[model samples]
Target: MPSPPSRVVAVVVTFNRLDQLKVTVARLLDAARTEGLQRVVVIDNASTDGTAAWLDAQTAAQAADGPLVVHRRATNGGGAAGFETGMRLSAEWFDPDWMLVMDDDARPAPGAITAFHASDRTGAMAWAAAVYFPAGGICDMNRPTLNPFWHRGMVTRTLLGMLRGRGRDGFHLTQHDYDARAYRAVDSGSFVGLFVSRAAIETVGYPDGSLFIYGDDVLYSLAMRQAGGQILFDPAIRFEHDFTTMTDADQRFKPLWKTYYHYRNLLLVYRLASGPWFALVLPLMVAKWTLKVRFHSGERGQYLALLGRAIWHGLIRRTQVDHAQVLEWAEPK
Candidate 1:
């Protein structure tokens, strides 16, 4: 008697990116059989750009017999909410052994899923793929990182990097690590190409959907680690992220509303990452973000105001701010 095949269900959270969603879905479906993918669930976040219709058509084409599963939301709930819904539904409906989560603009590279299924994934509760841009460069946003607060050397390097204005390069996986053939342990990683085991989900539960966007993945991954779940970064498993490149020199947030989520959720992430050192770490993090306001000269006043509010709300763990209010604040007065 042989062991059962590992069941994998992919969860993609999409909003208004119909073109990218189409490409991602097609790739997932094409490799489903070969990679032991049990199902592909697309959580449509009330996209108005014919995304709903397209998903309906795909479902019809499959006659509800294929591996495709569509969960259409009645409202635009951002990526965090979309992922929460997709993961819960996937576990309830398909009961897969693992749930692979990624954004609309991301998908596994050719043979990547096959490699994942073939790898010896023992002991790790979650695994992150080596995500790269379409041009083959590493996607900095998707890089896996160790928790600096958990390691003495990492904390020292992080402090030195911050003082030198180099950012936190100490905890992040190096280019050499990506090129290596061995897997590395990571404390946290982005949602793109992250595979979460059912056991981990059962222990830590779903991601914090209230986060609404930025930092949700980091928070969830850190929570997984805090719950004693090990996360591994396997370079052999690869993903392609078709997203716009934003350099560190350009620290301004477009649409402005995203700034609130970025800063607010960042506070929560820092608290989780630092634990007992949060009191000391919070001020340093705030100062770092404040220094970046110099780059937002076009909307410096509004940017600073938003940052203040974000900091206040984050301190109180408040997440009920309406999106409409955020949009109004972003509007030019």
Candidate 2:
């Protein structure tokens, strides 16, 4: 007899994006039966919109065996915290074989989850889907990357590519790789379409909630790799990220306070990526981020101050800074 279908649960972290969350949930529900989706655990990060009301209604309308599970936070804890809670809940409540994690604006393509179950995962502990924009192009930000520090050839190629201005394609998956049928080994990937096995979670634990946002997925996935867990990028399993793109000219943090988390968490990511060579990599990373302040013009002072604080806190591995404190610091003087 054929083996039973794998039990896959989806964890979606949402905050104020009710419309997108609805789409994501609807897609998951639509594929529930066909894809062996046991449950969809949605972590609402204190959304003020009608999200709570909608979720409540959905929960009330569900049967005893309903697949929808909503956990509404009393306070906004950012995506990282939301995922941490969602993943824990998923394992405790649904006991799925694998947990699929994504943002509110992302969802798997039709039959993608089925394809995931059908694929030969082999030695991989986690699998990343080929995330693409709604318009059918590769989502640059969601691409999986190889850790250059882990391999000498990767380090040489990445450094040479950076010197030649080849962008992240040196370290990240190439277009050719995306179009291929086989799974490729990746050191880290975004949360948009990442599927983590229960065994991997038991080994590496959940994502760091203290991160608030940014680099949490990379750090978590890198931790898995560091623990000898292989992560594979499966092009056959596709996901769509319905996110707005920013041009290079308009690529500054919107709230400004976000700069703190972005830079601080990035430091932790670099440290994890470089391992013992973090000290050697620190100056170069800091310099690259520091030079970006020139583009902020009017907010250069505030930007520089945030960068300084981020560097200090990151070096000390401090993630206890309050959100309100970051907001106060970002205020125009």
Best by TM-score: 1
**Over 4 Å off, model 2:** none
Off by over 4 Å in 1: none
Give the alpha carbon lDDT tens digit for every residue of 18-115 in model 2: 89989999999887866778898999999998999999998899887888989999888888999999999899987888899999999999999889
Cα lDDT computed for each candidate against the true fold: 0.89, 0.89
Candidate 1's residue-wise lDDT over 132-153, tens digit each? 9999999988999999989877
How close is each model in CA RMSD to the real structure?
Answer: 1.3, 1.5
Error of 1 at 245 (Å): 7.1
What lDDT, from 0 to 1, does candidate 2 have?
0.89
